[model samples]
Target: MKVQQLQNAVEAFDFDINSDEHIPELGRLIADKQVVFVKQKLTEERHYDILDSWGSPGMSPVIAGIGLGKLKGLHWNAVRNTTARIGKLIDPRHRSRMQSVTFQKDHKGRALGIFTNGKLGWHSDQPSFESAQRVVGLASVEASEGSQTTFLSTAECYDNLNCEDRSQVDELMCVNRWDMISKNVFDHFAGELIEEQHAIMRYNGCPLDGLTAPLKGQTASGVPGIHFPGSLFGYFLGMSVDESKKYIKHIWSLMDKPEYIYTHNWKDGEVCYMDQAITLHARPTSVDEGDMRRMWRCSGYLDKLYPGQGPMTMKINVEGEEITWDELFKRVDEVRKAEYNRTKWSKIFHKMP
Candidate 1:
């Protein structure tokens, strides 16, 4: 195995994924570098194996059905055309589970065929959940030109903050609400919210009430950093929403410093792994419809480092009996089919203004 620094804080390695030492060595590298980039083409089985070695495989409520014929994990089919339509037409409750990021356009040069809006705001993955993801891995199957992913280390950002600022933020907790942050995006695509379908679209049993998480959390190696993700909807628990926005914006200014940021231009066969809990990432809106940008993404938790916080567990009332996570999914799948069958054409056409 050969390892080298891709940037000041990101490392790139040429190592055998099947080797016995791969997991420990990669874990150490992830500790030292907030993100690690490796150049290798991994098969689906190998991909899941690497993710499983890190922690329990995370299941996205949105992509649960996508993995029907595949393995039993959160598998996202993030093709450009499919994701674009799903983002707009799918119910918000279900849309949240569709967490793949893509920027694809059609031959007409219009933005109608992409899932996430261009230039996704800087954010860590799933901060609204009680147990935010710790590690995220993305492998490029097809690379897009003029597209880059930018990352900022929250640990580094926190270190750069003045002592007084750090002290104030350290004492606070932030409320993360998926609905508030995503409201405009969803509204832009899906029009007004569908009140009746709201309850069915939840992901991993996370409540719509939102999560109250500490502003600072420790990495696996005990490095402390800001844990809040970049979303318009969060607020410092005791502060007014406006006050929280001002404070978060101040932090964003600090993080925007060039020294704390790294940009990676995607190359096919490259796999990038990030410690999502301590890092924020964003992508520019550069892909046109003809651009071929496809990536396979997998994320997992590091329970030992940030334990008792994630792998959200919830009990669902199923015919008067509480069911487990697996059982609940089965019930959800059945309901999803019924709903789709009932409103297939209307849901698709209703998104058109």
Candidate 2:
């Protein structure tokens, strides 16, 4: 493979996500490259805003950190604490109750995968929560020694699509269901609330005027970040098996350009964050199938900013600050207080006539 280079060892949109000190804004580098490489260095906080929009159609959950970087050196409890921090940073509407899941080889009797032969097909994260999730986080707790992440940007695919294709699929929304029992999605971000009652399709935030929905993406910068996930929209449009397959293949090809893809080769002790609207992430499985790979996923969204940004907020780095596990645990406990019990309620009960 012809490894693309950048000025003075600082590369943007590189497939390899690793230890370095350069962060590149990819919107400017879309000339010949489709992806941006964000080399990681230990910092006090994370970068906010990507050319202004919180959602992304290119690569998601705006990636950062590697199992080998920031995550590698920390204790498992510390990692869990950091993961908890991610949950707190999400929007309140969706974060009302968040699920914490660990992706590990032990669960599968070996390794688990989001991409590869036995994995789910190309997909966006979290399609089933009543409270839409905007940002998603993944840390390589035990990433197979040579494993890395491959991100596909849907923005480029949306742009290259023909008018007819766009029209037919534009208004279509996806029913993103998470089959946790099947391993397609985890239970933490997949299940419905007590009030939702075994529901499958997530809510569509599209305006009453039939404007674009969250999954359809907005047309602000004049660049259509993405159409809809082909599987979901194809059914709505009544697309033929062959026809949909062709378009899906075409879009997949466009996203494969080295310039458009950010391959994250992890080093111990790092983390990555990306805009979910624009990003799609996956990774290869282990060759041995006997090695243990442990990872933790915590997410938030930009639409769901720290102070109730929406379901779209994924991670907040505490502005490069550090807090002990005990401190983090106390904060989490405070948020999900056990004081809501009936006995506690009667202490200050006020009944109406």
TM values, all candidates = 0.67, 0.44
Model 2 lDDT per residue over 98-217, tens place: 222223222323212222122223345433222234444444444434666566666656676678756644754433222212322332222221222112122121101111123355
Summed over model 1, clashes come to: 6
Q: Pick the candidate with the highest TM-score.
A: 1
**What lDDT tens digits, residue by residue, belong to model 1 across residues 126-184?**
55443456677776766544578877777777877798889976887666554565666
Candidate number achieving the greatest lDDT relative to the actual structure: 1
Q: Which runs in model 1 stand beyond 4 Å of their true positions? A: 60-117, 182-207, 304-310, 313-353
User: What do the candidate models score in CA lDDT, each in turn?
Assistant: 0.57, 0.36
